[model samples]
Target: MKKTIVTVLYLASLIASAQPTGLPAAVHPAEQLAALDGGFWLAREQHQLRQLDGQGQEIGRLAIKSTQLDARGHIAAVVDYGSQQVQLLDARPGQLQRLATLPATHFSVEALCLYRDPQALLHAFLIGEEGQGEQWLLSASPARKVRNLSLPPGVVHCQVDDASRQLLLVEEDFGVWAYPADAERPFQRQAILLKQPYGKLKGGASQVVALPGGVAVLDQAGMALHLVRYVGQSWQYLRSVPQAQERDGIASLAQGILAQGVLAQGVLVRDAHTAQWQLSRWPTKAPTKPDTLPIVLPLAQTDPVAKLGDAADDPAIWINPSNRADSRVLGTNKKQGLLVYDLQGKEQQLLAVGRLNNVDIRQQVKLGTQTLDLAVATHRDDLALVVFNIDSDGVVSELGRIPTGQQDIYGVCLYQPKGGGLEAFVNDKDGRFLHYRLTMQDGKLQGQLLREFRTGSQPEGCVAHDAEGVLFFGEEDKGVWTTSARADAPSQARLILPVGRRLQADVEGMALYHGPRHTYLLVSSQGNDSYVVLDAQAPYRYRGAFRVGINLDRGIDAASETDGLDVTSANLGTGWQEGMLVVQDGHKRLPDGPQNFKYVPWSGIAEALKLD
Candidate 1:
């Protein structure tokens, strides 16, 4: 018998799936124009305070090269270094008056302090510094001369006490010192050390306020708030509040710590007694209820991205309001990459994107005769806007990538003008949103830079309705801000939906949905595995929350935090490719581990979301 030879050939052809028939087929190269960069630039220019109004609508606009609001939020002082003029406006009254003026010089004012009591005529004092550490003080009135004041080294900011007689100087090192307003010499440096001069606090202080009976201080870390009481001779730590700090609206009261904002609602009363100090709201005589823990639905996937150890965040989902029954999701995998999936729990495609910070998608607005689905991917280094064409055959193609400089881009949105051809808005890491227009010419897109807008510090999330001509942006330390593309050349922006809740995690992702019952907003908490569903209409109720938990195949890592989510319900034609919830599974790569990515089905997530 001649030897028997057994050979196995596992040769399977890898063919691209034929474009789904019945839908529009997109033309190649002609549809290639990355709009993400256009979006980022628009966010940057629109980040400023475009207009300010008081109690009602439409008031005279406040325009200045630079302006700073006082601590009380009552007055805004604008001294245009270039114009050599100073103006004061009653922020509440919309009252603009030329308070005083200054000579054109290299020096500029940095802060405005007003007396707590209005009876005092001394409009507090304004402190500023110039070349060679030269310090000058000006009277709130313009007629007053700029008095030279001898100040200590590294005086970054200044504040006044209730009596306006004592000046609180926040040193560059973040140390607090008290100097008499009439003192001739620099501060006699009686520093109020919160932690008894621990090995030099990191980052230094940002804000400091004197609390009732004690001084409340914010650390350089920008994370915790501390209260120090004068224990006879030395400063003693009374208590340190983290989750309930000012950013979250929890303040210290005469009786105890009063927690306000979002953590105070829903529940009748807290656990009453716990290891942590408790503050009771007066139900009968108790305090009012505080916002309770937001409702969350955990996807519960244990894979790397959904694992607790992974530094994941910023999740968005696309859902068809007409048919909530089927939806799809697109999310960023933090440093890992971006993952996409269908509504039936099947992985469609996994692109090797680097450190994808955010993923946003909107219906292809008809630009000329072409309609394209605007898909944007942002990274820490640059903004990539890849337009995908939903061709007549229903096939999606990667058209092109819009590239900005090497900087982090966080938020992205499509602003579809009432007419056609969409303008994309993107929030950059530098705290601004840049706008760009996607023009369809010769069967292709040519991205043209439109303009830029000022926004809050560290803008991380954005949602826009090009058809409505409105744009919404979110900040980590600030609230949700809105701006109109249809507004004047200056572009009007304001805080429309203030985030009353002080979140441990910064608001990173936002999705807008118009439904029969109401509009809905889904926000992602990047620091923790939590998502808040808010009513888009009426009172904007706290609808619920969703997170990544075990039932969703996410392991019991107990440390998973949610980031980036995009919900789409293609079954009902919400402009999504199909029914899928695209979510970014924030998973870290192990030293010698396999790749990282997670995809959850729309039906699978529905079950988890319905857990209540």
Candidate 2:
């Protein structure tokens, strides 16, 4: 026994020495940046590719509009923005090929990544935005004639999960779409990771990312974040994250954005005042420093969420109107119900949501109680209206359920009647809008349907106000409609995105916020994952559609589908509130399985509205 004990001690020492020490030594210093690879390819706005090392140091420079890197620190393909062409570089010794013209009009290179076949033929998949759908361009040569990869329309971003040997395509509202990369027809639906549609948000066009054990996702509803793992034969929810309340301040880095089982990066802010670009870098267990510092990039346009695909879904803000404060936000998930976020968009709590759909918070409420804000939500399976007391420990309860045949009800609203009573309104899948009288006794909702109106078919949006004595809504196949407090009044619904433009008018969600000059009507469309802002007073003309992505054919061939839409106040940020909108994404499950959650910010929306 003593001999065995001595032998164990000797073996234990060998194991101890084999393990790496948790020390604070610099993995790659500024002077030794070339030692590291596999990081984000950093570049300036002019499309100048600046090879940044792990320590955020420039190791080399390549004047190209866009670039994709290989395992080693070498440029695979470089696009010449001026001439609209591509230049291939030799892998062994980095040298660019003279000239190569790609058979794509206005072909700008983006979403570049490397994928290899089982035979070890390393190929690069590059996606570009041409017309309504994205162009899938694949290349095996560093700069050979770019091959057109025939894929389904609506593919916005893609990734080849080397571990799963499959391609994952994110279609807006359809769910996490997967396809076997090795198959001849590599673009057929394989498996749906998870899908739950909340009113306005589409189940397709969401984002996906790989985790240690399984995959995680930001649901298309823009209300929740989820983590799912394949156990025996089914996908089960390992964890769920809640929704975030829209705020005005910037979130600090100390309080990281939390989702699934890991840390999430927050908004990449470019300090216009100081011309410095600040990126939120979450701490990882691996010994590493930030890839980029808080310095302005070479080009002016710097939207970090641009290339992130669908990971950006939930929107949150710090309460103090600054990036260095503690804060909370409200968000949602497809599997879980509602989620409240802290200052950093971290999951505060995941509420037990039952068929919960779209959620909107009333800001600038001068109510006496500290809980001034009110959250309104639509339901899926039932006509239930989920209402929450907007306080620190706010509790969301069923305010009242509409009794119109438990079909598909999408929109909900809280309005006080001029006569005295408070009213609740809900939209239905079949063409009708039901109005209810909300009777909240001791913080519990007890209600009944007061009246029902024919608002064309598939009423998608609902907005009402007692003070103004006006209610507004819109239909999917129809156009915008409005009514008054007078019961005998005839409802007047107008065709906003009229006839020919009706192709672009699959209205999904709507919100009315008090703009500086006028009340802006924010409308949603699942057809293109876009939104339109209309003038409140007169001439409700077009406000350019907000553009987002749907990577439908990274590896999977998918039927293009878009759904779910919500518009937050531009004042969601400080001062005027940077007008931001969160759209739900559906087809985002990738091979090897990963989290696919997406939310986009329309800082440009605020600018166009002159709010910025």
Candidate 3:
């Protein structure tokens, strides 16, 4: 009889019918729960957000004053919290909808999350609250734009991990902070703190999860559970788990902790042979190991091309002052325009020349009677600057365009002024800046604007030293400024790297290097993918910060959000004969396709910062 109707349909699918008995009990006290995919979401405390099922049965409610979850928990945003609005929904299984709402802001949102980046894009951070009380972090994007981000005045709650694409936060009496939820850099009011390990610690952290190399939290009036981890760029303290009550949400399951308490909820399970002997006793202290940073291995990579999202961003080495292994790097492909590599990273040329964004190189220019070696670039389609000459067998030709009547052209640099000619600084998208200069009349090369400055907000990675007439730029939200490359001088500028120290707020791509006695600079600490270096002279001091990691015998993959970089003391022969840096990886992760450029080996950053 067909196995007796398959044993009565496998006992009615193990007695399915989750529990939905017409639900009603949470009009105001859940505080947070989550679960999803056919059941549970809660959030209560009277602001409402329900959505039950699987026998608890409300099935979708949402008056919401708060709720979050997206880092693939499948959507859910909510939040009205005094009308700083936002909706988002779509939590799956039978599919709920609402997808996008956002709009309200003059501050008042009170904590939110969502993140998606790795080129997936979806953003949305929102913590708001300022009417003079301060507390920011806004960030939107789904094209609604937004930005803000200042935070650190008592945060209260925020969480995003998506497996260490991190965003954490917490703060009532000051503790946890983290951030870098990969919105591709520029939100850094300095956070990575963590603190509050004991010193009269009693309550406050109410939930935080993240795990797999640490995070856990959960305190809520001392029903404890800690575990921090990160060490090496800070975060430490690893042990706590005492909890016999009060949890109000914790998660992290595959077979172990679920928490959720209004009086003790369950799921602790994890004994399968002593859970790796209880994580090998968990407790170690002499851990002060910090200066290590040296991975570098990408000997040859550059023919993959299929652009779309972040089509690589900036790189410019060009050495070959007559074959240093025939060197030549260029790179910019900001959605099609310049590429050229070789010194093994192959690809020799692309040049569609339309988008182009930030690129530089000067090397021996003279022009009218000929000497050439230019390169320029910053053409965001037509705000112009382009140029390019090279040749002598390394190729690259165009040699023209110079517009810059500025509309959005951004970040470029090429100086050459130690006493004779050539300039070009260019910046836009609102941090103003112009400079120009370059000459060669009857033979072509033009540019003349001379001077105009600004830098109040959105600047872009610039560079120039030309034997110290100085220039360095990058104000994208504030940090790294230095000025006066002589255009009548006096534009004054200053503020070295100051958006929460060691550069963060999009203060990207600067590069100087020089060295023989330390010239350094480097910057591009694009909000923590790391590079900072300094001491290019003066009080520029702070000399340390690396990150480019991961090699696996040349399989490579660990440079994140970096945007434009190029260094070279010029040796360029074997594994970068004491020189080469290149970068622009913005998440290239090995054979993982699209976006490229990453070739470190400045002697592995001079033996990982023992510098010289």
Question: Which of the numbered candidates is closest to the native, going by highest lDDT?
Answer: 3
Question: Model 2 over residues 467-581: C-alpha lDDT tens digits?
Answer: 5677767676666656674444655655555413423556656666554566677665545434556765446655544433222222321111234444444354332244444
Q: After superposition, how far is residue 81 of candidate 2 from its true place, in Å?
A: 28
lDDT of 3 at 591: 34
Better-scoring candidate (TM-score), 1 or 3: 1
**lDDT at 477 for candidate 3?**
71
Give a tens-digit lDDT track for model 1, residues 236-326.
5555444332231111112110121212111111111221222222111122122333222233332334324444554444443445434
**Model 3: which ten-residue window has the lowest total lDDT?**
1-10
For this target, which candidate reaches the highest TM-score against the unseen true structure? 2
TM-score of 2: 0.46
Off by over 4 Å in 2: 1-335, 363-372, 393-405, 416-421, 465-467, 485-488, 502-505, 549-562, 568-576, 587-602, 608-612
- What range of 10 consecutive residues in model 2 has the weakest lDDT sum? 1-10
Sort by lDDT, top down from the best:
3, 1, 2
lDDT of 2 at 252: 15
lDDT of each: 0.43, 0.42, 0.62
Off by over 4 Å in 1: 1-328, 333-337, 344-346, 353-355, 379-384, 390-396, 405-407, 485-490, 497-505, 527-529, 537-549, 552-560, 568-612
**lDDT by residue (tens digit), candidate 3, 1-612:** 000000000001011111111123442244444554323343333466655544335656655565444324456565655655777776664455566676666666556666544433355677753311121212223334423456666565676655446677666454566766653343453343344464324645544555544555655453665666665456666456564444344432221111121111122212222221011112222212223334344455555545856888888877777678887888888788988988777787887877888889887777667887888988887998988888767788887998878888888888888776678888898779888887778877788897798877788888888888888887867788788688877998888768775566677888898978778888777766778788877798877777775444455455767878888887777777778777787755333457787788777777767777
Task: List residue ranges in candidate 3 displaced over 4 A.
Answer: 1-32, 35-233, 238-359, 362-368, 371-373, 376-415, 418-462, 465-508, 511-523, 527-560, 563-585, 588-592, 596-612
RMSD to the true structure for each prediction, in A, is 30.3, 23.6, 20.5
